[model samples]
Target: MTKADVTGNNHTLEVRDTEQTMAQEKPTLTYFARRGLGEMPRLILVESGIEWTDNRVDTIDDLKASGKLPYGQVPLLEYPDGFSISQSGAIVRHIARQHGLYGKNDKEAAEADMVFDGANDLRLHSRATIGNDTLREKFISEVLPKWLGFFEAHLKKNGSSYFVGHDITFADIAVYNTFYNMQILIPAAKLEGFPLCQKHFESIASRPRIAEYLKSRPYTAT
Candidate 1:
């Protein structure tokens, strides 16, 4: 069993039986005590209907012993024959491609890439803020105006209901995760004023798989 520390508690996860499993056994993942980075990948894995044991690594000793990382980062994908892969975006994209969650064609994939990568950029920068001041700059100058403008334009040009094709993709999933994070980071009252943002947020929140996952997960609010 592989275990990780989450909020001072031990969270252990076990993959499918290693021996009884075939050479094509589903890959495994490990993540930090916190969520989001690994959370998205875990969500992708689940949405893909793939089996995995989520190992939430806790201590340096435990992490070092597991060899789940090619480098010392949480949220690495352990493949068959013990080949571990890092980088959350790369891992998630790979899974999306494999599971047809990326897009139908090259053009669709390209569009999905734009949304996914753009949302990721938004998330990384937003997480850097620590308080109301930073949040204002982000929500007002940066996130609100910049992202909202971009979002409005994209939705106007594309479609407000969906980012990519006629169906859902990791791009939408990525953007939804950003909105999910925004609820925690950005004040609810501020978000309420952003109608487009709020619409996007609600649409994702209502997604069957994501909504169900949010309901079932222990710390979904964050």
Candidate 2:
């Protein structure tokens, strides 16, 4: 090759290498030592095949003092370029969008949001029952049936393995994580009646990267 052509090829290779390095830079997830809200983002990162740093904190005092938290909360996702966002739901959505796991198009994205919101509603309501006998019982007997039935019907209506479109999205991840958390809190609450929900949960869990994550992640009740 001519010298000029060799130089051009070298420049192209250099640019490609730099782009790869930037893509490989790991985004750091700042949260407590436990799973809590951090788990969803972690699952998404793993499933997306993105290597990330799980910066678990023992206490939020240091993080709060750092002034990085928008709402003084954990589950802050920070990229290598210093871009950061707080709020568990926002972080989850951001990662989903970044990785094209949000949905296929606007309509499917909205549907995905609907699924995630419904799953989140169940998560919020059920979390309130933590340590309360009557509330927990009511959640198991009443709330679970209501929400899980909705998910089952939605899944059947979609007529696919996913909650939104043909492919997996953050909506599926949200549902899987929600049920995983719920089951931890209420051990007796299994997906016995909800066949589709159970199948979806197992499907996501069995994904190679996600299954590896589930198997190796530190066990946490929350």
Candidate 2 residue spans exceeding 4 A from truth: 1-20
Name the regions of candidate 1 deviating beyond 4 angstroms: 1-24, 65-67, 131-135, 188-190, 193-196, 220-222
Candidate 2 Cα deviation (angstroms), residue 67 = 1.3
Under the 3 Å rule for N, CA and C atoms, how many clashes does model 1 have? 2
Clashes of each: 2, 0
- Top lDDT hit: 2
Tens digits of per-residue lDDT for model 2, 1-222: 653476667777778777778676778998887878888888888888877888887888977898988899989988878889888889888889989999989999999999999989999978989889999998989999999899999999999999987999999999999999999888988899999999999999999999998888887656
Error of 2 at 14 (Å): 5.8
Model 1, residue pairs in steric clash: 4-56, 4-57
Show pairs that collide, candidate 2. Answer: none
